[model samples]
Target: MHNDDLSRFFSENMAVDGELSFQQWEGKVLDFAQRVSRGNCKGLALVSSGGTSVPLEMNAVRFVTNFSTGSRGAGLVEDLVVREWACILLHSESAQLPFRRVMDNMDTERFFTELMAPEKSSAVASIVGTYSKYKTRLLLVPYRTVVDYLYLLRLITVAVCHRAECLRTMPMVLLAAAAVSDYFIPRTLLSEHKISSNDGMTVHFSCVPKVLNVLSDIWHTADCDVSRLFVTFKLETHDEMLETKALKNLTLYNCDLVVANKLQEYKERVVMYWRDTPGSPTVLQRPPNGSIESLIVDCILRRIECDATGGGRS
Candidate 1:
């Protein structure tokens, strides 16, 4: 019989044998497979643009940037793929991760020369070629500015929530990982050439809508349990008082878990407190230096399984 069929059959007959049997072994194997599969999913996803926004004029105008190079976010994406999660990577302008690979013959000279070619656009051609080869079952939403990112996020939020409400079977998990810009410049400044420094510039600044706040509020109204959604927080600071601040923020935000990271240290991490309701903060013993991605994925998956099975400890 096929391996999957055998596993299924064994699962069905697990209760028949009072003593443990190969069926139990099969169950363990399946559990491990599922964990790995969850890490490598090519499923539906909506990733936000990664970068920091810097304020230009004290409180008025600002720069909508596609900065920070997106390395950590890209690494998180790769880790998700390992879990079998399908993702729709929403890439911002000037993102560091190159979604497409270069051609064998590509070089600076070729790239510049191709720009002047009268034939089909090289950019379009490259896209077509890459999509044709990599079975990238993903819907890519490209954005050049912070406004575009916000709009796309809102659109996806509505769609994903609608699906969750309509389809009562599978649960939807949202990971709020993007470093969204907190401010934007006025539309009038988009075309402005130069402003004289003699006259002080004043730009009225407004807060960018928090995507997580929206999600959390709406989902709470829907009466979804906090355990159903996992939110992660990244805090960069000194170890002296980082944990206290991180835990306080977690309590305020009501996230399932907050990974308080200190930039100065290597693999060793000081995880800040946890929920008073279900359990306490888990202290991870000295993890390997280059295993943050794996640790995060494992923690999330474990929590998912725990919640799915009625909050039972595994």
Candidate 2:
């Protein structure tokens, strides 16, 4: 899409309530990016996770949302921090968080009690210590609706690119792991208040614009002279069409890598199609007691390291 068309798309589809506070959010992102750029780190990773919601009304009592607990994205952040990569995590408001996932299996009552206990458990203390150790390395940005997600994403990406240009030598990676909504009701079309249930309702939705189409252009034109990689994910229900769709997106979106997985086996394995060798993609498998995200992050970091050394894409 051309720049004019992209502008029109955003103007038409991204209108939201005034409560979004995008300026404040943008300031936070800029501050985070600047801090990371000045610090000594391997590279910068902008990791987006969770699902965006489509509000049915301006007041937003009803909405549509994608299915995502953000576990994969959270796990990716944890592994990236371990590798000494500064990360900006953009996730849904209610999604799972990095470091906090260590308590996922604990009962809700026990989890709250442990936090309030005079003596913290080993698990809670460890998690807290890890969080403190890497507090400056990770920036958490949360969004609620699809409008907010897209707006915040663009803002954060621009900030990162700008800061990267200042450093001129840092590598950058855009890891889009969020389960974003494909359809939404524009703000102009949404009901002003909560819809009544007195009668049957019929609603219409408009397709969400493809941001991936323009992301590469943004990175290139933001005065950023650094090694950059763009990675996107594809989740399909039909196993037969998974690779085909992933490859198609890999080419269509100009992505450096497309991680494809079937809905039924997403937690177990994912096939990675690289821009350099789409035909000979790599398949990543989860370990018996480890997360698939850990393997994925390792592969991405290796690619980044290879590119930094003047080696071709991995």
TM-score of each model, paired residue for residue: 0.59, 0.93
Give lDDT tens digits, candidate 1, residues 141-245: 455455455444544555444433332233445555566776665443333444456887666655554455555554344434434454554646677467666
Report the lDDT tens digits of candidate 2 across residue range 1-314.
Answer: 66567657667765444335675766776776678778888888889999999999988899899869898799889988878888899999978999987777589999898878999898789888988888799989898988788777877777767643454577888899999999988778999899999999998999887888777667656564567888999999997799888989888888989999998898999999998899999999999999999999889888877776778775
Name model 2 segments beyond 4 Å from true. Answer: 13-20, 116-118, 221-225
**What is candidate 1's CA lDDT for residue 203?**
61
RMSD values for the candidates in order, in angstroms, are 17.1, 2.0
The whole-model C-alpha lDDT of candidate 2 against the native structure comes to 0.83
Q: Which stretches of candidate 1 lie over 4 Å from their true place?
A: 1-46, 52-66, 98-137, 164-168, 186-204, 209-211, 220-227, 265-279, 283-290, 311-314
Q: Quick one: best TM-score, which candidate? A: 2
Clashing pairs in 2: none
Model 2 lDDT, residue 228, Cα: 83
